[model samples]
Target: MRIIILNNFFSGTAYYCFKFREYRLFWIAAFFSNIGMWSLVYGRLWLMRTLTESEIFLGLVLTANLTPILFFSLFGGILSDKHNRLTILRITRLFFAIFTLITGILIHLDLIEPIYVIALSIITGTLLAIDIPARSAMIARIIPKEHLPNGIILYSIIFGGSAIIGPLIFAPIVSVLSIEYLFYLIGFCYFFTVLILLKMNLRLHISKLEKKISYSRSLIEGFGYIKTQKNILYIIILGVIVGLFSSSFEILLPVFTDEVFLGDSRVYSTILLLLGSGGLVGTVILSISGNHFNKLSVLIFSSICLGLLFVIFSRITNLNIALMIVPFIGLVNVWKGTINTTVIQTLVEENFRGRTMSLQQWSWGSAALGGLFTGFFAESFSSPFTLLISGILIIFFSISIGILLLSLFSKIK
Candidate 1:
């Protein structure tokens, strides 16, 4: 019996890549693309930090990068539902690669300015507003419905794993070469993804009903669908809260590393590596566990863990303790996100998948808001205090919601 169970576990793990061949190609493309995106993000942040050394500037840049999602994700969703998703994906990736290459050349010529970076960020963010939703919606189209949860978990792994690898890969390169070269590398990474996607056979499956609706009308219907679904509504609310309070960690990390830990870029890289490692571990566990557990329960539990761990992470004065705790911080953070995304994807209809996922992307926008607030707050106060206040507020909010969710679950049970 134990042997049979073990065999099933291994088979389930391999099924998505082996049994679903097309999804494997899609997965590989997504992995490299994500890595490239994250490398760009890391290099951009590091460049900003080295140039300005201002917390508020960091916040502003991050906000510029993320704010487009608020304005354009719905449109992206509409396009995804109305047009060929693969084509949209290809166009956005190509655009990003071109932009990144231009920025690299300017930087190499020592002609790059902070304003140029900000402008580039806005352009990249605008493209991402479309790319993210389309890519997410494409998953359901590629993989069978029964295997979607596994596919989603695997996607999370790519995201989390890339977060770990991107920084590590770039940090050393930045140290040895120059920050300008990092931009070139990022461009090449995106180009690599485009090359991979060029060879794959992709088809966009759109329903007749989706084709009939006007873009604006389709967006409204998507919003209307989200309003009617309580589970999805609650999940989005929780995600927004988490994003608003918890997502500032990355924005503040350079400050935290320098001011709090008295460390340099290498230390910053180490902390991120640990955080990413923790996130990767959490994603692996969730992927292996499959759908055996209750997703809502997992979401609630991981959220509370995130709040508590973040609070502890905020107050620590010792570098060793901070390093030790950050992994758990990564773990719970990714765990919460993975479960939240899977639940939303599972509950949403195919017609509304892109829009619903776009709504979900708002959580990142909320985090962008958090970055702005944390930056100004850190500028006014201190990094540690800003983190402490944010963490405490998250704890209060999460615990309150967790109680309500528990009561609702009890009634359901």
Candidate 2:
């Protein structure tokens, strides 16, 4: 029996490894690095709560981390277009790995004050501003065009899966192990990611004409081009709306666990893991089959379903049923992530890919800000009501965006 189980596990692992080889080591490094990133997040948030015991403080810390993204994202986009993406990614990953190590040391030494956390947040956020754009732009370079959509779906799958699993593992580890050690685990993963990145031979091409343009012009031109794109605009606007309503809800997961679920850490852990499961399922469906479907229609239908799932999740009193429905959230997440990226990647010119992706990052950051606000506001009143309001808003927003998209696409045709 044991041998049978072990064989099954190894076979499943080998299958995924085979699928991932199409993009080579670049995607593997990214997958591991992403897991570390979320692990760090899980550690950071748990550490923050352990220290401050204030939800507001957590929100503030998140704000500090994201504020720089709002400012420097455009610059990062410009660099992505003007430089070698793989090289840029390697440098940033190394810097962040070192930072994670240093941060871990400080935590171990009992030097992790709020001010230090703030400083670390800002520095890490700045590095991410550059790294994220480069990473997103580099995706197209590593994979064949025919496989780009699958690559995107696979990217979402692993990323969302990692996001779920990282926290599940970290939370329990922190419960038994010292919280400071979690940072060490994160650093080690990051170091491994850097090693993998170093080994991957990838180069991004920037044309001479594109090089001649000023950085400011490159940044503005990308946005200008996107402004004239009907599909891109609709997607971005709809994405922002959904993000504003749902993105920050994760920040309050700890609170909901404590208050609604009676301070059970197991329940808290389950919520996050379940969310990841949903995302994984969503990504699998999209990658295997949804690529052949109409992208716009997928986005519209998924957005509506996502909103409804949130509503159902909001009303559930039973934990088991809630867990069952949580994977739907992940499914919607995969749909949103894949559709948004595929649309932009297909519509934008090669030269403008970085800037446009930066815009996507910006939309996320901006939505995070809104989400943070929504979190605090909802917490101040009632958590359940907050979830309800967020769900309703998402539904309304999706309907409006879908109708607008239909009208615009028709006119374009």
Candidate 3:
């Protein structure tokens, strides 16, 4: 009976893989690219901590990394709509690879400094602002509309998997060797992503009317469409709230690890590893059962759970307890993000998908804004206190949103 169950599981997995064969290459590319991105993030944060133990400086680094997403993501959406998304992806990836290589070389020569790291982060952030809209918009092109939710979930799984694997690999390297080597690995991964892109043959089906609209006109139209769609607007607002409160956890993690846990790099990596493990589990669960659940309810419940977890996490002085709570945080994080993305992708029209996703990116950009707030707050008070305040704010906002949603549903009924 156990053998039969194992066989059935393998068969189901194979079938799912076969069904999404059109996205297989993109998935492979995303896996490597995501690993590189995570490695860069881990390395960047570690390096910043080493340079200055100031929470404010760490927050500034994160702000530099995410600021471009706020400014350029909508413009990227305009370009994605106007041009071939595949081409934009390829070009952006190439530029990012080049930038990574240069940074690695500079670090290898012992010429690295905090300002250089901040500058490079800004450049990478700008590239990501362009890359995200194009990459997200391209998913609809490669897969059938009915399979989009699965596709998005699968993509999130790749993301979660990379987050797990990247740190696991880089933690030891950063411990023994140098953070500079991680940059070299990141560059290679980006280059590998370019090769995978070269192998893909995707044809985006854009309407001639879509092609004829000016970029500025397209931007205005996208906003107008979003204004008309209350559901989409609600989701975006939720994203912004989550980004502002929940996402700041990462920016403040180093301080949390150092001051609270009285730990070193290994402990920090362990926390991140646990978080990624939880995210992986969450993604797998979502992939299997997400369609059976209401996406909005998942978002609302997860947000509340995350808020509670953050509050609990803030109070924990024990390393083991803090470690245990982080995985749950990761699980809720992936659940919220996957559901939100699936809903937005499903609701938006094909012509407006890029722009809509760009708006979503802006919601994510709220993390930078949050980092600034958390950084300043951490500098004034403490990391734990900052987290406590963030958690309370999240709980208040989530419950208010839930009540609002309930009222709207009753009125409609």
lDDT of each: 0.83, 0.74, 0.84
Candidate 3 or 1, higher lDDT: 3
> Which 10-residue span in candidate 3 carries the lowest summed lDDT?
10-19
Q: What's model 1's overall lDDT?
A: 0.83
Task: Write the residue-wise lDDT of candidate 1 on 252-358 in tens digits.
Answer: 88888888899887888888889888999998888778767788878888888887886787888789999999899889989888888888898899878888999
Query: Roughly what TM-score does model 1 have, to 2 decimal places?
Result: 0.94
- Error (Å) of candidate 1 at residue 105 is 1.8
Sort order, TM-score high to low: 1, 3, 2
What ranking emerges by lDDT with the best candidate at the front?
A: 3, 1, 2
Cα lDDT of model 2 by residue, 8-108, tens digit: 65443312333444366876788788887877655666677677866766666666666677888889988988888888888888887888888889988
State in Å the error of residue 32, model 2. Answer: 0.6
